[model samples]
Target: MEETISIKDIFKTLKKRWKLIMLLTLIAALISGSISYFLLTPVYQSSTQILVNQKQSKNQLDSTQIQSNIDMINTYSVIIKSPAILEKVIDVLELSQSVDQLSQKITITSQENSQVFSLMVQDSNPLRAVEIANAVSGTFQKEIKDIMNVDNVSILAKAELKENPTPVKPNPLMNIAIAVVIGLMAGIGLAFLLEYMDNTIKDEKDIETILDLPLLGAIQKISKVHNKG
Candidate 1:
């Protein structure tokens, strides 16, 4: 005979080990919160936008020129992160980081079929992120004029400092929530595992299930009488 467990049995198991589950959950939450708040370093991001427009006379403006500008925007995005631009930024800012390190912190992205692109920078300091973003945009604009011989690049927007800028990573609330869920799942799994591994006959139900027979009766233990003999 095969035996099947019901939802009630699962509920009973969980209730029996509720204390252990709660304890694990609390422990996980504490560890996650600590790592999020103290161990992980927060990174701040700042971004600036630049507009790429061809310097053409009113009579020279046409669809071909606009399409060409849009196509060139892709190349411009690549050039903005190149060492040619980053080296100048480093020298101007007097930053100790190398070109490769600064390049990793810089990001250039443009919208599909758009003439404007944005440069974003990330750093541990919010002010430094803003400075890097603005400096990269300015340096790229000046260099693009010399490299491409096009004086059409213009600064659309400069990065501004915020009074209370928010860090982009190390979200404590989200981390804690995830940890709690994982901890609860682990605890539930362990409880079921231990229950499955246990093979003790504690009651009439166990006997009936194992022997595949109806429970006849149960005998109660009584104290043995002792006489001074």
Candidate 2:
């Protein structure tokens, strides 16, 4: 015979196992919050903007020149992360990290149809992130002339260490919220699984459903009450 479940059965199972579900959720939240707050290292980001513009003799800006500069941003992005620039930056900054390790922390982004691009760096220390960002931009600016025969790159804005910089990673509340959701889902799944696995008859409803038979008479327990004599 095929067996099926109803909404009522689902609610009944959840109601009976509410305590277990809550316990799982609470445990997950605590674990996630603890890891996020105490165990995970916080990463900080710093960014510096650089412009790819040459000093034009004529005051009027040429559209073709501007378009060419914008198109060069992609090539510049790769060159900034190359060993030619990163190795120089590492040597100048006295950093212990290799070119590949430093390159992993650096990122470049540019606006659409614009000559300006940003160099972003992330590190466990906010001051270090800022220092790396500025150093990378400076090294790239100095080396591009020799590498590409173009003296067009200039630092527009340098990354700075703030007095009260905030880390960009290890958001505790978000992690906890995600954990709570996962735990809730897990709890609900376990609840339904347990209900499915249990086959013991509990009451008249189970007897009638499983045996396909109507409940007959039942023996009632009689309690004796003694009156004051």
Candidate 3:
């Protein structure tokens, strides 16, 4: 016959192994917290904003023309992370790193249906990140006009040193919270699995039901010692 467990059985199993469940949950939370706190590197991000100033013509450009300009800007945004642009930034900052090394720290994104592009730089040093972001923006603005045949890329915002820059990854509290939830799920699953594997009768009712016979007696287990004189 097929076997199944009821909600009562689940509760009883949990009560039996509550201590082990709690310990595993706590251990998982601590391990996740420790890994997030010490094993992950903290990255600080700095971003600079530039607006596309397309010269409005007397004749209104079609939607296609406007979208083409936007598409062109997006293309330039990718090229901003290229070695050409980063090499300039490295030289201007006197950074002693290869172009590939420097490129890894930069990101370029833009707002949708808008003409503004944001250049974000991330590094262990917040100040260096800010400097790199601003420098790249300036360098790109100076050359983007010649490269893209457009004269309207202007800096709208400059990266500044944040008083309390926040790290971008490995959030410890959030990680621990996720770990605790996962641990609880694992504990509940393990509890049910062990309960499913146990076939011995745990109560008098189970014995009576299985054998279809009256339960003569059920004695509570006890431990005692008697001295013989």
Candidate 4:
């Protein structure tokens, strides 16, 4: 005969083994929390925005010139992070770091079909990240003008100290919460699977049904087996 599990059976199993599930969940949460707190490195980020303005219009009413300027700004964004730009940034800051080191910390991105450019910098130090971001943006604006012979770049926004810049990496509470949920699900699944696969007789009813016989004597298992020598 085929056996089936119902919601009632699931509820019974959970009721019977809730303690085990809770314990596993707590353990997982604690492990996750500890790892996040001790083993994770914190990263801070800052961003500055620059606007791409049309330096001039050969014909002040030329839409084509405006489009060309926007396209050039996109290309300039890529060049902003190139070694040439980063080298200048490092030199001006007098930062005791290599060009490659500066490059690692800075990123330049632009929105599609938009005139805004974003300079983002990440570092272990929050204040230093903001400083690097601002310095890179300022350096790019000045250098790009000279290189492209255009004067349309303008600072839209500067990175500011976050009164409450919540650290963006290694969220211990969130990690622990997720770990706890996963552990509870895994424990419950394992418990139900073990219960379903268990075919050994556990009660007198099971023995009677298996043997198709009348009730017989019952005995309890002893802590230690006795030898019949």
lDDT (CA) for every model shown? Answer: 0.91, 0.92, 0.84, 0.82
Backbone clashes for every candidate come to 0, 0, 0, 0
Question: Of models 1 and 4, which has the larger lDDT?
Answer: 1
Could you report the Cα RMSD, in angstroms, for every candidate shown? 3.4, 2.6, 3.6, 5.7
Model 3 weakest lDDT span, ten residues long: 1-10
* Per-residue alpha-carbon lDDT of candidate 3 for residues 49-72, written as tens digits (9 for 90 to 100): 888766777667677656766777
Better of 2 and 3 by lDDT: 2
Q: Each model's TM-score, in the order given?
A: 0.89, 0.93, 0.82, 0.77
lDDT of 3: 0.84
Candidate that would win on lDDT: 2
Tens digits of per-residue lDDT for model 4, 1-229: 1234467777878888888888888899989998998988878899999888776635465677667767987688677888778888777777888877878877777777777878888887788888888888888888887787878789999998797776667789899989999999988987788788888997997789789998869888779878998
Estimate the overall C-alpha local distance difference test score of candidate 2: 0.92
Q: What's the candidate order when arranged by decreasing TM-score?
A: 2, 1, 3, 4
- Model 2 CA lDDT for position 169: 91
Could you tell me the C-alpha RMSD of candidate 3 in Å?
A: 3.6
Using lDDT as the yardstick, the better of models 2 and 4 is 2
Candidate 1 regions with alpha-carbon error over 4 angstroms: 1-5, 59-61, 221-229
